[model samples]
Target: MISQNTINTVFETARVEEVIGDFVNLKRAGSNFKGLSPFSDERSPSFMVSPAKGIWKDFSTGKGGNSVKFLMEHSQFTYPEAIRYLARKYNIEIEETEQTDAEKAITDVRESMYLVSEFAKDYFHRTLINSEEGKAIGLSYFKERGFTNETIKKFDLGYSPETWDALTKEALGKGYKLEFLESTGLTIPREDRPFDRFKGRVMFPIQSMSGRVLGFGGRILTNDKKAAKYLNSPESDIYHKSKVLYGIYQAKQSIAKQNNCYLVEGYTDVIQFNQAGIENVVASSGTALTPDQIRLINRLTRNITVLFDGDAAGLRASIRGIDLILEEGMNVRVCGFPDGEDPDSFARKNSHDELVAYLEENSKDFIQFKASLLMKDAKNDPIKKADLIRDMVTSISKIPDRIQREVYTQECARIMDISEQVLVSTLAQLIQKDLTEANKKQKQEQKPFEVLRNQNPKNTGYSGGDPDDPRTGPPDGYMEEPGYPQQQQAEKVDILYRLERKVIEILLLYGDKTEEFEDVFLKSNDEGEVVMVSEKKQYKVHQRIYLSLQEDEVELSNNLFRDIFTDIIGFYHQNEKFSLEQYLMRLEPDFAQEVTDILMEDERLALHDWEGQNIFTKGKHETIAQYVSETVMSMRWFLVGKIIEELKSSIQPENSDNTELLSMVMDYSKLVNSFSKKLGRVMSRYH
Candidate 1:
C-alpha cells in the first residue's frame, strides 16, 4: 500500500498541465490551457486544463477530473498505478506499508500481464548484455548496425537465448505464474511443454506512451530462408499493435516541442533516427497506417513527414496511407532517401547535420511528391494522365478543411499542368458523391426503426406504454397511481436535481470564504402569532450553507451529491485550512471526479476572450455572499414547493375526512409563498 503522505507529496509537486501536456499539445488560452481531447477525435481543441485548480475537463466527452484521474482515464492506469507513475515522474520515494493478501489480490489481471511483460523485458535485456550466446549473436547484430552501447540501453534492446525454455523456466523459478506468462505471450503454451516465444532473436520492447512495457517486437539474427525475419508479440490485454506507435513514449516531448513528427517503417528506423539526433520520430512497426495510430500523433502535432525508403515500388505502395493522414486534417510531407537506402542504412552512413539537411532539402508536400512520382508512369498518355489527376483529386478531397482542399487542388493542377477550374469541379463532384453515400447509409440504418414505428403507431419509445396513451394504457402488470402524472416525473426530478447541484457547487467553490449572511427563521411573537424574522451574522460560506440546510431539514437528493456535501462539511470542520488539492486526494476517484466537475464547470467560459471583446464577466468571488444565499434560498424554495405538491396530492376528492390534508396544504402553500418572496428579493439584489 502506498502511504498517504507520499500521495500528498506527489499531488503537491506534480503540476496538472505539466503532466497532461506530455501527452496533449496544450496551448495557452487565458489562464487555462486548451488542447485536442485525447479521448475523442476533434479538429478543434475542446480539452481544457486549469493549473491553479489542479483539474482538467474535456468539454467534448464531459470527462473532468484532477491529474490522477486524467491518467487513470486516458492511460487506463489503476489508482496505485497512477500514483506510482506520478511519483516516478517527480522522483518521489514511495513509503509502503505491508499489503494484506486481499490487497495483493486487488492487482487486476491487466496489471498482472503488465508485470509479466515488464519482467520479460528485463529478462531479455539482461540476457543480451550478460549471457554469452546473446553477446555473440544479438550484440554483434546491433553493433554491425552502428548502434552504440548507450543507444541500445536507452531503448532497452535485448536478446532471447537459443534455448527454447530459457525464459519460461527462469520465470517459473521466480514464482511468476505460468498463466500470466502465457497470457502475455512471453511463453507459448503447448500440450508437450511451454517454451520461449522469441528464442534466438534480438528483442525490442514496445511500450505505451506512458513508458509501460506492453509487448515486444523481435528480429532474427540468421538469414534462414525458411524463417520469417521478424516476429511480434501476439495480441494480449496489454498490447494492441494497431493502437500504439513505436518510440512514442520517447518521442512525445520532442514531437510536441518541434511540432512535427517523422513517420518511419520499422523499429530500427526509430532508434537510428533517435541516435542521429532526430528525436521526434516514430515507426508504424511495418504495419499499414491506422486511424488510431494517426490519432496518437495528432494528440501531439498536426504535421507528419513520412520517411520512405528509396525503393520506387515500396514508395508507390505506401503512398496510399498519406490519404489517411490527410483525412485526419493533418499536414503531410514526404521525404525519400537515395536509391537502395532506407532510414536505418541512410542514418548510419550520414552525419547528423547531413541527415537533417537531406530531410529539409528533400521533403515535399505529399501532393507534389505523389504527382511527380506518378507522372513518369502516366507520361504522354492522355487516359493515364487523366486517371492520375482524378487520383490526386480524390486524395485532396479527403482533407476536412475546405480551404486546405482548395489549396491542394490548385497545387495538383499546377503539378499536372491542368486547369484549376477543371480540378475544382472534379473535387466538388467527389465530395458530393461521398456525402450522398453517407446520407444513403444513414437512411438505410434508420429503416428498421422507421418500420417498427409505423407498425406500432402508438409507440411512445418505452417498453411499457406511456400512461398518457389512453388507448394502450400502461403495459400489463403495472398500475397508474393517483395524482402521479408519469410524464412530469422527469421534469420534477430535473428541477430539484439542478437546485441541489447548485447548492453543492456553491459549497465547493466558496466553502472557505467568509461572508455576512441574513439568516431567516420563523418565531412566535408576544401576541402568540407566528412571524418570519431575519438575523444578520458572519459565517464561513460552508458554515452558512450547512446551517441553512440543517435548519430547513433539507438534504441533497442525489446520493453522490449528498455524500460530497457531507464530506466537504466534515473536512471544513476538522481542518484549520482548506486545500483543494489535499481535499481531492482524500476522496476516492469517483468522488474526486464529481468534485472536479462541479468546481471547474465554469472555467470553460475562460476559453472565450469575452473581456478582450469589451464584454466583461463577473467572478463568483465578487458576489460570494449573494451567490451563497441565493443558492441556499433556492434549495429551500424548491423543497417547500415539493412539500406543497405532496400535500395537494394527499387531499382526496372522494373521501369526506380530508380536513387535515387541506390544512397541511394551505400551511405549506404559505411557506412556499414566503420562500418565493425571499428568493425573489435575493435575485433582485444580485441583478
Candidate 2:
C-alpha cells in the first residue's frame, strides 16, 4: 500500500499540465490548455487541461481526470505504477509496504520489460560513446550523416555491437532477465542461447510520446542485399508501431505551441529537422501512416505538412496515404525536396534559415500539390484531364469536415477550370455512399441490441442518462411544468436517471460540506393522527441526500447511478471526514471519469465569465441548502408521478383492485401536490 502522506505529496506536488505534458502536447487556450484528444482521432482542439483545477478533460472522448488518472488511462499503469511515475516526476519519495511475491511478479513483468528496454537504451548509448568498435562504426556512421554530438545524445541514438551475444551477455551478466529481453525483442532466443537482434546496427530508440523507450528501430550498415536495411522491435505490450509516432515525445510541446506539425518519413528526417531548428516534426518511422498515428499528431495540432522525398512515383504512391490525414479532418500541405534530396540530405545541406525558408515557401495545399505533380502527365489530354479531376474530387471527398471539403472543392474547380457544380455533385455522391455504408455497418453492429429493444419496448425509451447531466432531469425531452404530460416508465426512468444523477452530483461535489437544512419530522397530534412539522437542522450535503432517499425508500433506476449512490452512502459511513479529490481516486475508472466530467464541465461558462453575456447560470454555492432540498423534492415529486403513470397504465376501472389502485393513485397525487407547494414549483403536467 502507498502511504497516504506520499500520495498526498504526489498529488499536491504534481501539476496536471506538467504530468500530461510529458505524454501530450498542450497549448494555451485562454486559462486552460487545449490539444487534440490523445484518446481519439480528432482535428479540432477538444482535449483540455485545467491547471487551476488540477484536472484535464477530453471533450472529444468524454474522459477527464487529474494527473494520476491521466497516467493510468494513457499508460495503462497500475495504481502503484502511476503513483511511482508521479513520485519520480515530482521528486516525491514514495513510502510503501513491500508487496507479496505474487503481487511483485504480477506487477514487475511489465515493469521489468520497461526496465530492460531502458537498460538496453543506456547500454547502447554507452557502447556508442565508450566502446572502440561503436565509435569506429556507429558514431562514425552518425557523424558522416551530419549528425552532431548534441543531436546524437538528444535522440538517445546508439549502437548495438556486431558480436552475436554482446548485449545478451551484458544484460544477463547485469542480472536483467532473458525473458524480458526476448519479450522486448531486444534479444533472439535459441534452444541453447540467445543473441542480440540489432547486432551491427546503429539504433534509434522508439519512444512513446512521453519518451519512455517502448522499443527500438535499428538500421544496418551492411550492404548485404539479403538483409533488410532497417529492423524494428516486434510488437510488444509496450509498443504499437502503427500507433506510435517517432519524435512525438520531443516535438509535442512545440507542435502544440505552434499549432502545426511536420510529418516526415525517417528517424533521421525527424532529427535533421529538429537540428535545423524546426522543433515541431515527427516521423512515421518509415511505416505506412495509420489513423492512430495521425490522431497522435492531431493531439498537438490540426495542421500537418508531409515532407516527400523527390521520388515522384513514390510521392504519387504516398498521396493515397496522405488522404488518411485528410480523412481525419486535418489541414494537410505537401512539400517535396528537389530530386536526390530527402529531409535528411536537404537539412544537412542547408543552414537553419535556408531549410526553414525552403519548407515555408514550397509547402502547397494538398490540391495544389496533387495538381502540380500529376498535371504533367495530364497535359491537355481531355480524357486524362477528366480522370485527374475525378481523382482530386475523390481526395477532397475524404475530408470529414463539410466546410473544408466545400472549400477544397472550390479551389480544385478553379485550378482545373471546371464547374463547382460538377465537383460538388461528385462529392455528394461519395458522402452519400459513405453514409449508406456507415448506416449498414451500424445496423449490423446493433443487430443484437435491436432484438433486445424489440423484446423490451421500455428499453427503447429507457436510454440511460447522458454523461454530462447526472443531476436533476435530462433537459431534453423532459421539462417540469412545461405543458408536458405524465411520464411513462421509460421517461420516468430517464427522469429518475437525471434526478438521481443530480442528487449524486450534489453528494459528490458538496457531500461533506456542512450546511443548515430543514428536517421534516412527523408527530402524533392529540387527535391520534400524524402531522408533519419542519424544524431547522444542520447536516452535510451527503447526510441530507442519503436521509431523504432512505426516508422515501427511493432507489435510482439506473444501475450506474444506484451503484454510485450506495457507494457514497457507504463511504460516508466509513469516514465522516471526506475529501472529494481523495474519494474520486478510489472509485473505478468509469465512475471516476463520470464524476470528473460533471465537476469540471463548466469551464466555458466559468472561464469566460458567461454571466457577463447575461447567461442564466445557477448560483451553485450561494443556495447550496435550498438547491439540495429542491433537487431532492424535484426527484421525489417525479417519482410520485412515475408511480401514478404506471398505475394509470396498468389499472382497469372495473377490476377488483380498482378502488384500491385509485386510492393509491390519489395518495401519490396528494404527495406530489404537497411537495410542489414546498418546492414552490407548479406541476403543469399534472393538470
lDDT (Cα atoms) of all candidates against the true structure: 0.86, 0.82
Q: What lDDT score is found at residue 427 in candidate 1?
A: 90
Task: Score residue 306 of candidate 2 by CA lDDT.
Answer: 89
For 109-150, candidate 2 gives per-residue lDDT tens digits of 777888899999999999999999999999999999888999
Q: What is the C-alpha RMSD of each candidate to the true structure, in Å?
A: 5.8, 5.6
Q: Taking the tens digit of each residue's C-alpha lDDT, what string does model 1 give over 1-687? A: 999889889999999999999999999987889999999988888789999889999977879888898999888899899999999999999999888999777658888888888899999999989989989999998999899999999899999999999999999999899999999888999999999989989999999898889999999888887767999999988899999899999999999999999999999999999999999999999888899999999999999999999997659646878999999999999998889999999999999999999999999998888887888999999999999898989999999999999889888888888899999988989999989999999999999999997886543333444443323444311322334454444345555666677787887777888888886768999999988899999999998888888876878877988998999899999999988888887888679777777776666555555567776776777889988887687777777666667777777777578988888878766776677667764322111
- The true-versus-predicted C-alpha distance at residue 343 of model 2, in Å, is 0.7
Worst 10 residues of 1 by lDDT: 473-482
Cα deviation in Å at residue 439, candidate 2?
Answer: 3.9
TM-score against truth, every candidate: 0.89, 0.83
| Superposed Cα deviation of residue 134, candidate 1 (Å) | 1.7
What is the TM-score (0 to 1) of candidate 2? 0.83
Which residues of candidate 2, in runs, are more than 4 Å off?
Answer: 1-3, 21-36, 42-53, 56-64, 93-102, 440-487, 514-539, 543-578, 588-594, 597-617, 635-674, 681-687
Off by over 4 Å in 1: 444-491, 520-535, 604-618, 651-687
